[model samples]
Target: MVRSTNSAVRQDAAPAVSERQQSRVAKRAAAAKPAVKSEPIELPQDIDSSTAFQLIAASIFRQVGANEGAVRSANPQGVHQMRIGLRRMRAAISVFAQLVDDPETTRLKQELRWLTGRLGPARDLHLLALRLRRARGAAPERQKRLQVVETMRNEALATAIAALATDRYRKLQTDVWAWIEAGDWLGGAARRQVPRRARDFADAVLAKRARKIARRARELEALDVEGRHQLRIAAKKLYYAMGFFESLYDGRKSRERMADYQRKVKELLDHLGALNDLAVQQQLTGSLTPVVRQSDGLAVIAPSRHERTKTERLLKSAGRAGRELADAKSFWD
Candidate 1:
């Protein structure tokens, strides 16, 4: 088991307030404070794999923290940004998994997953509610359904806030910060490889992710919903990985290649994400079934007739974007 050096240091400090009281105070403070915007992460050119991993992990952790206040207050952008931070952190861990494979790393990943799960429903519902609100000239029944969706979104947000205010969340933050600074991974036999140049590690990681995306692209038409979803995830990871290492490849030619590669990935993600939103919208609106039936005698929230056509269009666009990504020259090369 990996221990947190920070936890050990805190053990020697005198406690002024009970842990429960401190938690309440912290929650109040977070809710009352304004959220800080996340700053860009700039990596040093001479960074080693371990140092680069620590920098990336720590920056994302801070970004998540900076949005906690806004999330507590139910700010939509804050929730979106905080969720993005969590995803980026997850991608960072995955990218550096070989260097940081330890018991604590596994535990940390689990904790992060739990927090992300808590925030997921809130974000999803919030987006759905926003879209519904923007539907001008909606029927009276549709408006009522929108009210119910907003209520569900609020409930989800409350749950997410409660999760963030828990001791578990506090402990997770402390443990992750400590692990990033001084985890068992830093002292084990695997540490021998930690000093390798980040550029070389990044090249291998990017190539591996790109290959997966390319293979998936070849079968884009044949892929089922789940397969396409997995491909989207792979593409997202590659996108995040590319962003993390962007500063490393900084010459004019390198910058152009990176920009082009990033544009292709972003294009692919946009189309896939739109398709995902349609699917999620259906599921979310379907979840309002009981309420809808009780209030309006409707079977379920019906999708627009054009939804199929829209999905087909998105699929074609995603296929085109995927082909472009597969054919793009790797900036890391």
Candidate 2:
């Protein structure tokens, strides 16, 4: 009798969480209120890279799990938190990519990307609906559009909920936890690098990512939509990277410098985020049928003059923020 490869893989995989246990966890999550913000992870200054990575990954996993019940209930903030958690987890993986370059890590990343994709639409639609509600006018047409957005958001949320309940998701969670604890990356050639001091690792990663952002910032105004979007992503990754090492800089002076660095990066991210939101709003608005005028039969869907002005203002603000970030001193220095 020959053993099957599938059976071999199954034997090696982490034990799946039972459905009954999952139900109890879900109930606990549902009863708890979602955290308003991500709490900072505090790692010791002398911790090894592998240990630091594990702590960061564990914090992110907990965040993702904490929001599941709220997501099932269609809570907008829950959706946002869960999405951010996933994004941060992906960034963390990238930061530690060199030490975790195993096949299992790649497979886990693919699964995470799939889960993030499932949750994206709902978050985007929810933001769009909020924007529409906050607009100056309360026209019936606007209300109708808002209703359509809500319907789409509900559907998206339903899909996200279904995704959370899937066996694939359960296995993904189990495997991720297993990987964080004792993945293959911890053994073999990578083991040598994993034990390196996190501060040294932090300094190298921060300086490298910062350089990329600085290079992009130099021509901020000249960047087109796609370029700006890429800049936003780089800034976001750098921000998450910074958070991972915040606890390593614990001295009063170091803390202050780190705080300033974080503030500058965050400012840049905020401006870029606003710009992205404007683009997304434009895309969402364009997808809807415009309110038509009876007399001239013209489409009334173009962005309002106010919106055009806001866009111009946001562009200027984003450019300024980018420049400021470029000039700011690196805390890791």
Error of 1 at 244 (Å): 1.0
Residues forming the 10-long window of minimal summed lDDT in candidate 1: 1-10
TM-score of 1: 0.87
CA lDDT, candidate 2, residue 107? 96
lDDT of candidate model 1 versus the reference: 0.78
| lDDT tens digits, residue span 53-114, model 1 | 88988888999998888788766567778888899989998988889888989999999987
Candidate lDDT scores, in order, read 0.78, 0.77
Task: Tell me the tens digit of each residue's lDDT in model 2 across 39-109.
Answer: 78999878888889999999988888888877776676887899899999999999888887889999999
Tell me, by lDDT, which candidate is best: 1
Local error of candidate 1 at residue 271 (angstroms): 0.5
RMSD of 2: 9.5
